[model samples]
Target: MGMIVPSLAHWLEASELLNGKGMFMTGTDTNVGKTWVGKQLIHTLRVLGREVIPRKPVESGWNADIQQTDAWQLANAAGLELDNSICPYRFSAAISPPRAAHLVGKHLTLQTLAATCPTRWDKRQFLYVEGAGGFYSPIADDGLNADLAQILGLPVVLVAENKLGCINHVLLAAEAIQQRRVPFAGVILNNRQSLPESMDNLNDLRAYLTVPVVTFPAT
Candidate 1:
């Protein structure tokens, strides 16, 4: 599909509809710091006195002892207690949400995934919905991460790991996002490792994509 970049007016309209309180965070690839960046954003928003509700629609590779799941980490970051609203589907296996659901004898549908999210708008609390794995990663039997993001109708914050081949990944993710006509906020480059090409990739991405590209230092 041909990429179609939306005008500023489109984003403005979405912001108005959402009451300027919702966004989707998706990564270029797995372990690309989507949760880490999300945690930082939640912390920053909380510091600014905004009540933030973090959601990871589906999570895999659950750890019982540490409660170490993407959704748990995000919920903790927002200073909110854990609940189904934060993460609807969770699996112990380390795999994609759809596959994990399949292994558990449960079918994943886009409708079910959408229904698990917060449908009502709350003026006081901002919503940060994080997607599992990469932007194109499958979350349901028929839908990908981008589809879930589209269904939520929230602006997206694309996260990419700062490393080799990151430029291609970020650009590809951005292209898919553009083609979907999703309200894109911008991109965040997470420096997971210090590499010689880190700064170069950051600059190349800034020059390649029209959207604003920001960096997240190692934590």
Candidate 2:
């Protein structure tokens, strides 16, 4: 049978780009499958005999009853326990993390968030960090996700929901990342919904983007 998701080759390329350090995963927008792609990447790295450490640092829209916050899911993907070390700032409001932090009389800073990520890297160990929303979305009281990406200095993997207008979103985000001079690993177009085969969003993106443009649920 054909591969149902991204091929091993794609993951291998990603691994090489990461060079055993890890990647900062962001999305073009919320619900663009950043967590989903991060989980898959973690799994693929494990299959390649690499240790994966996943971090969600800060998450909004957290509900203890839900038990499925982004941080929880990321820790689960890495086979680690849910703890403050993995995610230190979690708010109940379903808004930008900085706004959510404000709702509870908390203030977050880019430095504080960046400090949560692991600095030490061992051979065959990967550290995966997922941002709260889009690349430019506000993540701290003082910075956007782009700012945090600059601080961490890890290569970025942008995930965009595949559908109408994704080309614009992907390109705009790519330009922003380029402006920041962050190492852009690639773009992952997640198929959250089926599109007409004639749409060919993948090729359209590849035509414009110089970086690798891969599709989830590999078309």
Candidate 3:
């Protein structure tokens, strides 16, 4: 299916991008559980009576056992079909998005990605966008996650794995997001693994950053 039409009002309200209950999920690093936390977020929102459409604009690491890509997992989480509307681009190589796209002789651009977004937002209550790699990881040849996030102009929800050295990564990512003047929507600390430094790292992040920090227990 092609891009769904997004709400014009949402596109115009640049200042209040996240103000309308939509969010863009980014991460401190790859394998940081961005999708793990995002999946739970979708479930929680659904229980709260909000119709959420999750978007993982670009993803790598194909899991053929389940189907093809991470989009399949996310689609299942959202209870939607594995359609291009949800993930505009999907690559098979377990590498950075730009390199993955290069292998297939196709180039990913911010314009093409931004254009893939739902053209008209009608009944959908929320648009939850997920980014590939880390905040500064190269998503396209010319753009990074920061660039895409800016183009989409949604409140940033930073997902970080609760582990040793996460404090530094999370803080650095937060700094980068703020530097770009993106709307900050707080952080989610995902306990994808049990580590002794988890609580200390979590506490440090909460103390260091002013944005709200929520925890996701290991599951």
Candidate 4:
């Protein structure tokens, strides 16, 4: 089968639905293609002539030698320079951000993480903040990604791997986001593999979720 990229119309609808300062992107779990979906959205926003402010804030599996770190990828997509403001906390260990910070005898707080994001917003600027790991995953010494999402006050966008059990994962994450009272933009089901079950994940998610559910092709 051919690769299935999201149409321009799909992204345009996304821009309209998420018509706010920006969005807080979280995933059902780690490695669910959060960065991939984020890059695509950022690219689309740029094409629409909106200034995109991409922030990863905290990344655990950071390797300075590698140029394709999540922060770098987000930066490259937004056509911005890789700087501390974009990803303030970086650890070489491939673990949770809090655990990675612990390994290096450093501690991160929710306030510090939230402060890294740009405060100023204009009609021409759109903020795209990507959370580390899943929504409940520990991003700082003090809080989970959900907590940061609440603090940022941006509409949450859930990205999940389009595979077996994805419906359960997306629903659970959505519940958590709703519990926090964060505005939910929608869901992006990333088809990274050609799993037979992956073909139906989008429809399954839409049936259970009232928000927009879109598919993203594998890279």
Tens-digit per-residue lDDT, 183-202, candidate 1:
87778788767787435776
Model 3 agreement with the true structure over 1-219: per-residue lDDT tens digits: 222223212222332433366777889988888787777666655554557777888777766675536677677777788888888787889999889999999899987777766545655477888888889988888899999889988888888887777888888999999999988878777776777642567667778887767666623
Q: How many clashing residue pairs are found in candidate 1?
A: 0
Question: Which model, 1 or 4, shows the larger lDDT?
Answer: 4
Candidate 2 least-lDDT 10 residues: 1-10
Better of 2 and 4 by lDDT: 4
TM-score of each: 0.87, 0.93, 0.85, 0.92
Give lDDT tens digits, candidate 2, residues 126-216: 8889999999999998999999999999889999999999999999999999999998888888877889878998898889977888888
lDDT of 3 at 71: 74
Query: Backbone collision count in every prediction?
Result: 0, 0, 7, 0
The C-alpha stretches of model 4 lying farther than 4 A from their native spots are 1-18, 197-199
Alpha-carbon deviation at 173 in model 4, angstroms = 0.6
* Number of the top-ranking candidate, with TM-score as the measure: 2
After superposition, candidate 2 runs with Cα above 4 Å error: 1-11
How does model 1 score by TM-score?
Answer: 0.87
Query: What does the lDDT read for residue 55 in candidate 3?
Result: 81
* Cα lDDT, model 4, residue 218: 29
Top-down lDDT ranking: 4, 2, 1, 3
Pairs that clash in candidate 1? none
